[model samples]
Target: MSPDLPCIVFVRSFLHKPDNIDHTEHHVRQETPKQIDGHTHRRKHSSDSEKTLTVEDWATSRENPHNWPLAKRVITSLVVYIYTFVVYSGSSMFITAVPLVMQELHLSEQRAMLGLSIYVLGYGVGPLLWGPLSEIPRIGRSVVYFGTFVAFILVTIGAADVSNYSAFIFLRFMQGLFGSPCLANGGASMHDLYPESQFPYTLALWVAAAYCGPALGPLLTNSLVNNISWKWTMWLLACMSGPVCILLFLLPETYAPTIRYRSNAFNTSHNQNNNNTSSQDDNPLAKLKFYLVKPVQITLQDPAILFANIYTSFIYGTYYTFFDAFPIGYPPVYNVSTTTLSLFYLSVLVGCLLAVAAYFTYLSLPNYLRKHHDNTSPKSTPTHTPPTKHERHLIPAIPATFLVPISLFLYGWTLRPSIHWIVSIIGVTMYASAVFIILQCLSMYIPSIYPEYAASLFAANDFCRSTLAAGAVHFGIPLYKNLGMARGSSVLGGVSGLGVLGLLGIYYFGERLRAKSRFVERLVE
Candidate 1:
């Protein structure tokens, strides 16, 4: 087959049903060799040579993951969250050892921080590779999870055993690269496994893990490092990886096209006429090119994608910026022990819990008001609708937009030695709460807006977030060191203040922005 034919065929299939397309007959295609016995491969050939197959339905289809039993869906979601938690912990676990690694390896400050800086750089770059591969019909999401989990486990163990600084840096980078698939595509998996109505609550939990893991990582590492050794941090993380690998294998594939292609009742004339496999099977480079280009295209083309990315990037960058800002106030003026400082991080966790509480509380208001207003009309049970474009707007997070800067101001101003340490911690907790609210809101809105390309949309968001945060960390530490904590944090707060405009822009004009974009328009349809 010609190189362009694969692209053309894919576009045609995507835009129309297989039966409607003149050139292709729809029948079950055994795209994956390792089928799940009766669950995956159920095909019946027609009396005539012609074949017919249809896409899975949203409600009735057994092949639809949304149609799975509630208990099974919950178990799958738990496994995905565990996978997310383990992988994200690897990113920040080394943070506590930054000082120790420098001392033990006889390294300079810049060189020592490279272990994290390079690892974060890998986080941004790795997904550009993983996001595309995860979408391949032949490979799918679970295969990517399985492969990356193994690589992550081995590299993490290598991190514990590294004899030299260069080896440490390389291994850390590899660990970040291998561990990034969940961060990039975990939301897409949630979209695959659950219907839209259930996504908000599900995302709240998953995103909490994503944020909480990085906050929790330093605490785990701090305890281990202070008591035993810094190297134990990597070993413990490797041990955690063992269970995640088991969980990864247990969850079956949920990517839709992959499922449809593997389903016993589905097939295509493209498979029979050309006798050629997926482009990923034939031209691996071309497949790679398609995957790599899609994220870039989405990032550039969609205004909503671009601004949502920028907003989330700044929020994430602020989260890392606080990593530096927190130490300056706590370790010096408060003179807290490493263990005590680690526990203070829990204030951020408390803030996240409060954010979750606020989310549910705010969510409940709409339901209550809607029911109260409609009570007089009839006693008929209400039916559910998929969230509309306006309903998915970031309006609910509007309260958070103002709160982040205000909390930042309070956190910065109250960090003086004259002030009580708990006062400053409280201020920072407010910052954490506001940030969590904003980040969680974007997490839900972006994926819901572009459900078809949710993984790539998330990949773009992660790319912006990780890259910006990694780049800013070098300057962040210096800012806190050169300027005093109060002044330094005020500067950080000022930057966060700018993000308010981004939130307001999307809130007011997001629908118009989405309407203007071809990619989002197509995806919405």
Candidate 2:
């Protein structure tokens, strides 16, 4: 019952700590301090009844995710990856079925495309709700992941059965809404299991799965769509998601606060006492409001984050635009069936794999080795000065930025029937690699600038990108139709070139902008 008990100290530390403080750095004394003769002294060999638990004890305990054996960690991370992949696949699986739906439902291409766009929009909105709910200790992450996915399965089933277009669109939106937690929180789950030093490696793998999911969607369901009813796409989603839902039950809660609160060391009386002393902001409704409002506020106020969101959003939109753009470019020129065209997406997957390798080789490996050397070397040993935190993230991104415009131009011009399809595939591959690098770099760099608001900023980033991509799905078809493939892609490439200038400006002036931010100023104070 004592406030000074080690378990109580750990609880209080977690409750009041900033959002981004590294969990691995937390340490608590193993012994209780006693006041004796007007001096504080450590009590040695305290009785079992008098002993208390500490963060240090928990850190080493089997319950700690960081202490989980390598196999358990890998399995857990893979489950999360599959869960994320399934959700993202749901967004694009319906793309191949668009023609069938358009013909059967008596709809325009734009109206049919709404099914996909609305789903993207749904996930964009869903994160504002899910991200905050998952942060609460009582709610935890596993509950959100499992519960939302069950809802996703039901919605997918409903979408498969619905004959009416309106009902179909609504169901698709629900699928995205229900399937969204993994997209936003999956990386957070990985962060719970891995130390900061190993996070980038795990993150790269997760991102690859995420990018590949949408790229593979058409390929996975192409035969189904071609051989059977278009409804098979939704059925395929249901089949894939149902088993993953069951597997999710095996995923233990990874959020530290939730695990700590559930432990025997956290007594009910202590919890009640802490709740009694908590501020109004600790209440559920206030917490929800803070989560919803804070992200928007931060996005608008921070110049670096605001522009980063714009640049990334445009890049994200461009990626989705290809879903529509590809059909236009490949079919007329190559005279291929839907199945063969779907095979072109393999190039995107190839690009994703290459990007992950490039990231680890050029960025992750060198930095890790440098850190390892610094830690092991003699104090007097000379070592090269390492890149600053922001610099490390920005370095690869600069070259990747240039690749985007160049890839776009190549892909645009190379779509001619005279040019071999492989040439255009190479361009798409280059664009995918560049996109992966830029997104991964900015994802890390922006959060580093304001760790306190990292979660909110991520939600903001997701919202921006998803909304733009939804629009891009609709815009891409018309742009290609009116301006023709070569001209349309050139327009996009020109815009991306402008984005390069914007990104370069951020690289140079981001620190100065951060210094001027009210949010950054408050954090410093």
Candidate 3:
């Protein structure tokens, strides 16, 4: 719906009492302009206003996407998924371009890979803003999504054109800066659109779509860079944004409170009626402390609280560092073309698909337990035993730990120009798959345990992960070169393997561990 169109403007006015408010179709913009390269063209925005929607609001409101007509909810999920796909694509789109970047910029292989690192830097930092900033009911979601996109597309062009290394890295960071809101909020938006029962599975689908960008980006860019210059790869990637904005223009505001507040306000003013407090008398937000949560406070305080979770930070930071580490070590070891390099992107896909399948399996266990047992309330079922130290989800990180080093060692040691590329690919696949499972576990577990501040928690985690990835990309090549791929990978693999010990410890003692953190404990029960 065009912001100026009657339907778009009418929906923004109160649905129940449109006559009371101004009915004219006006495009009321929000904190951020909503448009980016993939899904929108946006202008910069600034604000921190948002309505607090509790878990109860999620269940009872027919306006919530979970309660909306099935078709409407599906469309909403797809809309979010599309934006994630594009933002992720932008990150890895330069995978095959490292060589071109090296030659064009008069840099070494080590420095050239910084092009990729610079983008990851963006992802790390973006969530701090995008997650909290989009909370406003008044600013509207479309404006937020679209506005950021416009800034993102422009920055991509700038990054491509910048001649100086410092300048190019700066623009790439800006691209990430603008593009990150889509990744950060898209998950929360999905939560808004679906119930907790369906959140894991639906989120799995969204993650899989997000994973597609890393897989497809390298493959697509490899082809583009092979036929032409790396510039075409970015140009083509940015150009794909045109249609996404067209679709976003029609997308409705799915955030329920925004819709409800507008509707109620319209009714109160239109017929000279009473406020929600006077009319409905059952407004949940009446008691909410709305004014104190300024944007700056949210940005600083929320992240500080989340950063206190060492496990979330360590895991996210470690995962992305090693993820990019794979490209740095294996790409040069095998001497493959940009196109062939994309084949290395499969490790995460294999692991991700398994994780996705595992997500459904986890969902099925509860259902199966319900069927076999005499169940009354959904919460009272006793078919399953409580999780034990050994029976933990985080345990998967153990095997993944070994794969990280072992695969890299194998790829590094075996990857001579004379060796077939398949051996190296096997190593990459193993590492990607391992990383994928851990990544999924970290994201899902945090939310599962701390549903209240899941969005903020994710942002804090991204801050750690992105910062580490940026560092790893810059430092990884040197380590691999000095130690050689086998030894370098072995060392990294060992550290990552050591990380597994932490996961195992958590799996075994997580309950006791959760008992230690007030934030975790308070949020859970």
Question: Which candidate wins on lDDT?
Answer: 2
Q: For residue 507, give model 2's deviation from the true position in Å.
A: 1.9
Q: Residues 217-265, candidate 3, lDDT per residue (tens digit)?
A: 7776777787877776668667766566666666777655456555552
lDDT of 2 by residue, 311-364 (tens): 999999999999999888899888988999889988999999999999988654
Decreasing TM-score order of the candidates = 2, 1, 3
Instruction: Report model 3's TM-score to 2 decimal places.
Output: 0.72
Per-candidate TM-score against the hidden true structure: 0.82, 0.86, 0.72
Estimate candidate 2's alpha-carbon lDDT, on a 0 to 1 scale. Answer: 0.76
- Give the C-alpha miss distance for residue 227 in model 2, angstroms: 1.5
* Candidate 2 accuracy as TM-score: 0.86
